[model samples]
Target: MIVLGVESSCDETGLALYDTQHGLLSHALYSQVAMHEEYGGVVPELASRDHIRRAIPLLQQALADAKLAPQDIDAIAYTQGPGLAGALLVGSSVACSLGLALDKPVLGIHHLEGHLLSPLLAKEPPEFPFIALLVSGGHTQLMRVDGVGQYTLLGETLDDAAGEAFDKSAKLLGLGYPGGPAISRLAEFGDPLAYKLPRPMLHSKDFNFSFSGLKTAVLTVVKNHEEKVIANICEQDKANIARGFVDAIVDVLTAKCVNALKHTGLKRLVIAGGVGANSQLRASLNEAAAKKRFKVYYPELEFCTDNGAMIAFAGAMRLQINPDAAQRDYSFNVRPRWPLDEIKVV
Candidate 1:
């Protein structure tokens, strides 16, 4: 089956064509990071407008890359929620309109589910009944995955997900927007022992996570550095603080993931979402996996963020499992706050 996926959940406008027989045929993504960078964060209005401008051209590019006509697509899938409402509407409307035009089936996919299932797109995918860590800018969750749509929530952030903490702390250190990458890069020059930061709830009996306290700790450090403003802080201090913050987050995350795995007795660990792209986190997980004699899986870097490919791949997988999952209903609604575990299998 040929499925076209549209993703406009937030700052990215993505389109892709996925062939069940051939895997991902083609995918295109247009990021609004450059535009949003000027504002130090995303403006929903601007994000929505950019999606309007980029989605169609991206779709055409994806189709052209795949060498497929619109009519050749068997189904249309779109991220239905857990994003900006206006942005979600753009993708959903486009997808539904396309489905109507082609008389093809349409499916509304949960955004988080797309990220959770993205690892299957990797060359060496984890099998069923694995542990999954979905860490991104908007969310941080650990789940026990028995199979597609069979997810048991292990735990999630109480407040401020890991990615948010990273960005917030980076801003405190004078880093610009989308602070995760900037902080990670700066941490490379940092001395691991330069400062000690708190690891919030690292020893909690449950698998739950909390990064809010850690971010606050970073703020306290910045204040005590004798700098009246971020500009007054020296570069070395920034790198050192970034390292401390990164280490603390990595430690807590790694500990919780290990605890979740041991609790579930699942050896296969799958990391998805943007924070899963962190080099330090990957290194920590890799070392732990080797020591624990388990396996770890990740999506290709391109699939780490919001993308149409994961949505399309997820939709295709759903249809493969239950052909009746997709309907001819062109009418659709988006859930800007959908929960992953609420998704019921058809």
Candidate 2:
């Protein structure tokens, strides 16, 4: 089956065509990072407007890349909720409209599910019954995945997620919007031993994570340094702080993941969501996996962020497992606050 996926959960406009028999045919994505960067963050209205303008052109690009006509598509899928309400509406409306025009089935896919199953698109995919670490825009969760739509939440952040912590800490360092990448890139020049930062709840008995305290710790350090020096924090100091912050986060995440694997006795670990692209976290997890003698999986870099490919691939997988998973109804509504666990088996 050929499924067309649309993703406009946030600042990205993505469209893709996935063939069950041939894998991902083509995906086109346009990010509003540059535009939103001007405002230091995503503006919901701007994001929604951009999605409207980019969706059709991206769909045309995906179709052109796949050498397929709109009539060749068998179904339509879109990220329905757990995102910006306006952005979600744009994709959902576009997808449902296309479904109506083509007389095809349409499915409302959970945004997190797209991130959860993205690693499956990799050449070396993990098997079923693996542990998944979902660290996306505003969420950081650990789940035991028995199969598609079978997820048991192990733990999640009590406050700020890892991505949020990164962005917040970066802001404290006077970094730009979307601070995760900037902080990570600056950490490369840092001396790991220059400063020591606290790892909040690193030794907690449970799998739960707490990055809010860590972000506060960063703020404290920045404020202290500024007060003492009577000047803005220098470049080297910023890098050191970034290094310390990244290291602390990586340690806590790695330790919790190892503990979760041991607790569940699962050897395979699949990391999904935007933060899964972090170089430090990947290196730490790689080392842990090597020493612990387990497998770790991640999506290709292109699929790491919010994108149409994962959404299409996820929708196709759901359909393959349960053809009845989709419906003929073109009337649709989006959920901007849906939870992953609420998704019952189709």
- The TM-scores, one per candidate, come to 0.99, 0.98
Query: Residue 205 of candidate 1: its Cα lDDT?
Result: 98
lDDT of 1 at 253: 88
Clashes in each model (backbone N, CA, C under 3 Å)? 1, 1
The positional error of residue 91 in candidate 2, measured at the CA in angstroms, is 0.3
Predicted candidate 1 versus true structure: per-residue lDDT over 33-129, tens digit per residue = 9999989999999999999999889999999999999999999989998999999999999999999988999999999999999999998888998
- Candidate 1 ranges beyond 4 A from true positions: none
* Cα misplacement distance, residue 6 of candidate 2 (Å): 0.4
Q: In model 2, which regions exceed 4 Å deviation?
A: 226-231
Model 2, 105-168: lDDT tens per residue? 9999999999999999999999999999999979999999998899999999999999999998
